[model samples]
Target: MTSLTIIDLSNNRFSGPIPPNIGESIPNFLYSLLSNQITGIIPKSIGYMSHLEILDLSRNSLIGSIPSFISNYSYLYFLTLEKNNLSKTIPKSFG
Candidate 1:
């Protein structure tokens, strides 16, 4: 859905990695995958979401360092990755 603005799948207990091409598929403004069983790294293609404003992936099983490209989102205002297994320090340029 090119016109979609939000995708909230919070607390759904879903597992698995985020789709690698989600940004090219939906490019929504808000995306929430909170409180799930999701695993794996955040896809790099998510950086292609030009209109993205909010992203929440809390309480999941994600790993790897946060992508540095996330700081390029000029429209992003809210982001949360708490309670997950992500490692490494947040990118210095991130807000």
Candidate 2:
């Protein structure tokens, strides 16, 4: 939202956190807050956006893990935080 490119506040029942400077203020687009009710974690400065392609924070209530530099950026194709309450082990730069 810092200069906006393409953001979707999906399902629009927003909760807390997620505003961890928001990739240092929207550094390129395609983002979604899917099925809101958002909680904590996933911040890690969102790996500094770096012209991100597509990202979805699926189903809210996020916890920890999956940060792994968020697939080391490199123009993220499409990332979905599926079903919420994140835990360890889905890292490997996510496909």
Best candidate, lDDT: 1
Off by over 4 Å in 1: none
- Global lDDT of each candidate: 0.91, 0.84
**C-alpha displacement of 45 in model 2, angstroms?**
23
Estimate the lDDT of model 2.
0.84
Cα error, candidate 1, residue 87 (Å): 1.4
**Clash pairs detected, candidate 1:** none
Per-residue accuracy of model 2 over 1-95 as CA lDDT, tens digit each: 45777888899898997888778867767889999899989888878888888999999999987788887877778888899888957787467
Cα-based lDDT at residue 71, candidate 1: 90
Worst 10-residue lDDT window for candidate 1 reads: 86-95
lDDT tens string, model 1, 1-95?
77789899998989999999877788799999999999999999999998899999999999998889889999999999998888868899876
